[model samples]
Target: MAPTLLSSPLQGFTDFRFRNAFQHYFGGIDTFYAPYIRLNGQLKIKQSYQNDLQLENNSTLNVIPQVMTNDPDEFLFVVKYVQSLGYKELNWNLGCPYPMVTKSGMGSGLICNPTRINEVLHKAHNESDIVVSMKMRMGYENATEILDAFPILDKYPLKNIAIHARIGKQLYNGPVDLDAFEKCISGTKHKLYYNGDITSLESFKKIQNRFPTIDHFMIGRGLIADPFLPNMIKNDTKAYPKNRWEIFSEFHDRIYQQYDEYLSGPTPIKMKMLGFWEFFSQSFPNPQKIVKAIKKASSPKKYQETVASILKNV
Candidate 1:
């Protein structure tokens, strides 16, 4: 069977502008998980998060709204907000490994406390009919943390639990624990989705081979670094299209124009694209050189020129 490819949510990176352009230019992702809507003690959703989940904004693609919270009321609030936007499922984010989030007993930090996990899930299930799914790291400090939480997770009727195999402490640095991931398949009754280090066709196949039962796979940073990767993997081809760079350049321009229009100043757009280039540069021969040139681009015109020059060589 062909694998189902999903675009994993990257907090600052995979917003609506990026998602729309990616879907239009490169079509392979079966669904896109919107970056989690974080309600930092406020019951109100941010306008930016509101814009991302607007039904008209995502009409062309399948998008699942996600939330990052340790509070049940916050979970229920987001659940109502997404359901009102016509999304049927809400993906809870317990996978984020950042220090600020985890330090607050949210994201991966909350994984260690199954009782709290139960509290949030318990309220969400009791109050709403909206489907609930999970995005989780194996644990915060260690892999076994999830094992302890599985009993609590299994009590609820979750759509699925997508696990990024490394523990929270490792962040995105170490190898994904395939052995531990394999254990996850049996650890719960819920269907499991594999995520982490799936950066290439070969890597996707390796994970697919190991966990033949898992059909859903999520691609995060890899999708931005190589936009054509999902399609190529789906088609099982190593070759790029004859106009690979052209398509990429066009996609780049579309996003650049939109971001420039929406953002007030040159610096903001430059920094935004710079965040993207941190991944984009990896596709080139000299990633450091590409990043350095982009960083040195102090103005919009200079940024465009730098991008053109980088693409010109490829």
Candidate 2:
């Protein structure tokens, strides 16, 4: 069977604008998981979150809205809200490792508490018609933390479980634990998807070889680092698109223009582009220099000039 490819959600980066631009410029992702719609204690979904998941805003692509919360009420609220938007599936975010999210006993931090996981799952499944899936890490503090929660998860009919094979404490810095991931396969019967350091075709091949039965994958930083990665992986081709630079330039420009129009200040736009460049710079030659040039731009004009210079050189 052909493998399923998913675009992983990165909180600050994978907004609707980026998703739309990426779909226009590239191919190979079967589904795009939107960044989590965070529900605070107020139980209110932010307008931005509502706007992001609006059917009209996402008409071009297949999208699944992800929700981050440890509360059953919040999860159910998201269920009803997204279903009202005509979505049939919702992804629960149990994978975020950021300190602010984890410290609150949400995200990966909640994995250690099997009781809480059970409560949330029971309530959600019993009360809603939404099909639930989960994106998660192995554990919050230790790699084995998921062990206790696996049995609880098995009690429900999850759409699927995508595991990023690192403990939350590592926070995307350390090597992904393939052994731990293997253990996860043995521990649960649910459909599984892998999400970790799949940065290159070779790495992807290695992972495929190791886990031959698993077919779904979620690419996060890897896709951001190389927008062409999904196409390359899907086609098993190393050749670049004939007008790769032209297409990439258009993609970047669309994102830039959208941000510029929406954002009020020069600094906000410059900073946002700079953030994207952190991953985008890796695709070009002399990435360090490219990133440095992007970083040095204090004003929007300087940023555009720096980008144009890089594009000209490329």
Candidate 3:
């Protein structure tokens, strides 16, 4: 029942490096949206940020670069910048619901001010020479605000849309508000994409049953929790102990090895492996014991041994 897989943006987590690593071994995600590029006043693209999005890199695959700003001019600036890299489309961030972004009149904060979004979208289209799309939440402060936003977005011929199934204030805290999502879907006239807590195949089926029209699904935590998610979904695979450990190790060891090479210092590797454990914990044969040793590992050498020990158990 599920549609194609999309890798949702998870700010600190789904940067280009993470996306590439995940895709190399686990080929479930059909597309990956790079983390939003937070632009300041400068018209110049920072060296570090540009490096993160270099098109020459083979791992870029289906990566789409995201730009975060409320200014119409700034949006145009990024469009030209991304166009230079041969990208055919641009996705705007209107659904970010954090207080910091909202206070600045960006992200989900713009949902409350439909006129402003309309003004920016209109001008951005006039100036932009590339296909532009949008990613939004139901609303920032209230779901009704989307009503104000819909009339404007309906005017633009976007490539498509990706919407998180919640409002800004909710911020991935509780269950996704499906009722609100249905309302937004009904009110708008644009192609829609579903983005939210699709953590497993079971969850995906429920979405398929509810919304028979959906052709794309954007997943964040579910893919992170299980690297083999997309592969299993595509093949309709069940957990088989025979091939499970091999696939899991190939995914785990590849990423861990890369992190070890690039990140120096004791805590970098530790935090990364620990961060992975949040989802990796689900795959361990004995979750408690593996996680316990991983937590106790202090030095690089000790960390290496502990991770090896855990993977062996898997």
Ranking by lDDT: 1, 2, 3
lDDT of every model, 2 decimals:
0.93, 0.91, 0.80
Cα lDDT tens digits for candidate 1, 138-181 = 99999989999999999999999999999999988979999998
lDDT of 2 by residue, 1-314 (tens): 66789999998899888999899899789999999999768878899888788998899999999999999898899899999999999999999898999999899999998898888889999998889999999999898998789999999999999999999999879799999999999999998999999988999999999999899999999998899999899998788898988888999999999889978899889889988999999898888998899989888889889998898899
In the range 39-157, model 3's lDDT, one tens digit per residue, is 87888777656866788653547988888888888888888898898887888998787898899999998877878887778887787667878888878877778777888889998
TM-score of each: 0.99, 0.98, 0.92
> Which regions in candidate 2 have their CA more than 4 angstroms from the true location?
none
Candidate 1 clashing pairs?
none
- Winner by TM-score between candidate 3 and candidate 1: 1
Per the 3 Å backbone cut-off, how many clashing residue pairs does candidate 1 have?
0
Please report how far candidate 2 places residue 124 from its true position, in Å.
Answer: 0.9
Please count the clashing residue pairs in each candidate, in the order shown.
0, 0, 2
Which structure is stronger by TM-score: 1 or 2? 1
Model 2 alpha-carbon miss at residue 122, Å = 0.9
- What is the descending TM-score order? 1, 2, 3
Please state the error at residue 24 of candidate 2 in Å: 0.5
